[model samples]
Target: METLFGILNNCVYGILALLALWGAYCVILVWRRVGQVRFADEEDQDEFLSELEQALEMNNYGAVSELCEDDRRALPQLALYAVNNRNIGYAKLRRRVAERFQQDVLSDVEHRLSWVGTVIKSAPMIGLLGTVMGMMGAFANLSSGDKVDTVQMASDIQFALITTALGLAIAVPLVLSTASINIRIRKMEDLVGVGMSRLFEALKFAEA
Candidate 1:
C-alpha cells in the first residue's frame, strides 16, 4: 500500500512539473507577440502616426498601403484594408476591415491567452488533488495496521503540503503575467481604434 502511494505521489509531481513548463512556454509566446505589436518607444509612436497622417493628407493610397503592409502589427493592417478597398466606399470598407481583424489578429492573440488562463485555473486544482491523495495515504496507514508508521504518515502530510505550495507557486506568477498581457492587448485595441479613426479622416481629406 505504501509503495502504491509512493507511485501516485511521483505521478502527481511529474504532472505538476509538466504544467509549469507549459505555463512558461505560454508566457514566452505571449510576451513576444505583445512586443511585436507594441510601439518600440514614444518616438516610434509619434513617427508612425505622423507618417500615417501625412499619407492621408496627400491622398496617397500607395504610401498608406505600403505602410500597413510593412508593419507586422495589428493597427497597420486596418490602414492596409482601408486603403486597399477604398473604392468600395467607407461603410463597407470599415466593416470588412473590422471583420478581417477580429477573425485573424484577435483570434491569434486570444488563442495563446486562453491557454495561459487554463493553466492558472487548473494548476491549483491539480495541487488540491495531490493534497487529497497525500492525506488519504497518511490516514490509510493509521487505519490499516495495529502499529502506525509515523514516518510514512509524516511523509504523506509533507507531500500534501508541498503539492499545494507548488501549485500556488505555479499559479501566482502566471496570474501576474496574464494580467500584464491583457493590459497590452487592451492597448493594442486602443491603437486599432485610433488608427481606424485616422483612416476615416484621411478618406475625408481625399474627398476634399
Candidate 2:
C-alpha cells in the first residue's frame, strides 16, 4: 500500500510539472498575441491613424485598402474590412466590423486565456491530491510494522507538505499573470474602440 501511494505521489508531481509548463506557455502566447494586436508604441499608432485619415480624405479607397493591408495591427485589419464593405453603408458596416473583430481576434485571445484559467484552477486540486497520497503513504507505513520506520514516515510527511506548498506556488503566480493579461486585453479593447471610431469617421467622408 505504501509503495502504491508513493507511485501515485510521484505521478501527481509529474502531472503538476506538466501543468506548470502548460500554464507558462499559455501565458506567453496570450502576451505575444496582445502585443501583436496592439501597436508597438503611441507614435506608431498615431502615424498609422494619420496616414489612414489622409488616404480617406483623398477618397482613395484603394490607398486605404493598401495601407490597411500592409499593416498587421488589429485596428488596421478592422479598418480594411470596413473599407472593403463600405458599400453596405455605415450602420451595417459598423455592426459587421464589430462582429468580425469580436469573432476573429478577441475570441481567439479569450480561448487561450481560458486555458490559463483552467491551469490555475486545476493545479491546486492536483497538488492537494498529492498531499493526500503522501499522508496516506505515511500512515500506511506507520501501521505496517511493529517497529515504526521513523525515517520513512518523516519523508512521507515532508512529501505531503512539499506538495501542498508546490501547489500554492504554481497557482499564485499564474493568478497574478492572468490578471495582468486581462488588463492588457481590456486596454487593447479600449484602443480598438477609439481607433474604430476614427476609422468610421474617415470612411463616412470618403464614401460621401
Candidate 3:
C-alpha cells in the first residue's frame, strides 16, 4: 500500500511539473507576442499620418505604396490597403481595413494571449487535483490496516501539502504575468484604434 502511494505521489509531482513548464511556455509566448504587436507613440503615429496625407495630396502613389513596404505595423499596413484601392470609396475601404484588422492583426496578436489564459486557469486546477489525489492516498493508507507505517502516512500528507504549494506557485506568478500582458494588449488596442481612425481620416481626405 505504501509503495502504491509512493507511485501515486510521484505521478502527481510529475504532472504538476509538466503543468509548471506549460505555464512558463505560455508566458514566454505572450511576452514574444506583446513585443511584436505593441503600438508606437501617439505623436509618431500622428506625424506619420500627417506626412502620409501630404504625400497623398501630392498624388504621389509611389510614396503611399512605399509607406506600406517600409512599415510592418497594423495601421500602416491598413493604410496601404486603403491607398491601393483609392477608387473603392471610404465606406468600402473602411470595411476592408476592419476585416483585415480582425482577421490578420487582432487574431494573430491575441491568439497566444488566449493560451496564456488557459495555462493560468489550468495550472491551479491541476495542482488542486494533485493535492486531492495525495490527500486521498494519505487517508487510504491510514485506514488500510493496523500495521500502518506512520512514516509513510506522514510522507503522503507532505506530498499533498507540496502539491498544493506547487499549484499556487505556478498559478500566482501566471496570474500576475497575465495581468501585465492584458494591460499591454489593451494599450496596443487603444493605440491601434486611434491610429486607424487617423489613417482612415487621412485616406478620406486623399479621396476628396
Query: lDDT tens string, model 2, 1-208?
Result: 6677767878888989999999999999999999998986667787899999999999988888888897777989999998888899788888999999898789989999999999999999988887887788788877886688889888888888888888889999999999999999888888888889988888787767
How accurate locally, in lDDT, is each candidate?
Answer: 0.84, 0.87, 0.76
Q: Give per-residue CA lDDT, model 3, range 51-99, as digits (tens).
A: 7888878878799888766677777777788778768777887788789
Error of 2 at 24 (Å): 0.2
Candidate 3: segments with Cα more than 4 A from true spot? none
Q: What TM-score does prediction 2 earn?
A: 0.96
Comparison by lDDT, 2 against 3, better one = 2
Worst 10 residues of 1 by lDDT: 37-46
Sorted on lDDT, best first, the list reads 2, 1, 3
Q: Candidate 1, TM-score vs. the true structure? A: 0.92
Q: Which digits, one per residue and each the tens of the lDDT, describe model 1 over residues 1-208?
A: 7788889999999988988999989889988987887676546666787888898788887888777787887767667767777889888888898898888777877898899889898889889999999999989988996799899889999999999999999999999999898988888777777667876877778778
- Name the top TM-score candidate: 2
lDDT of 2 at 7: 78
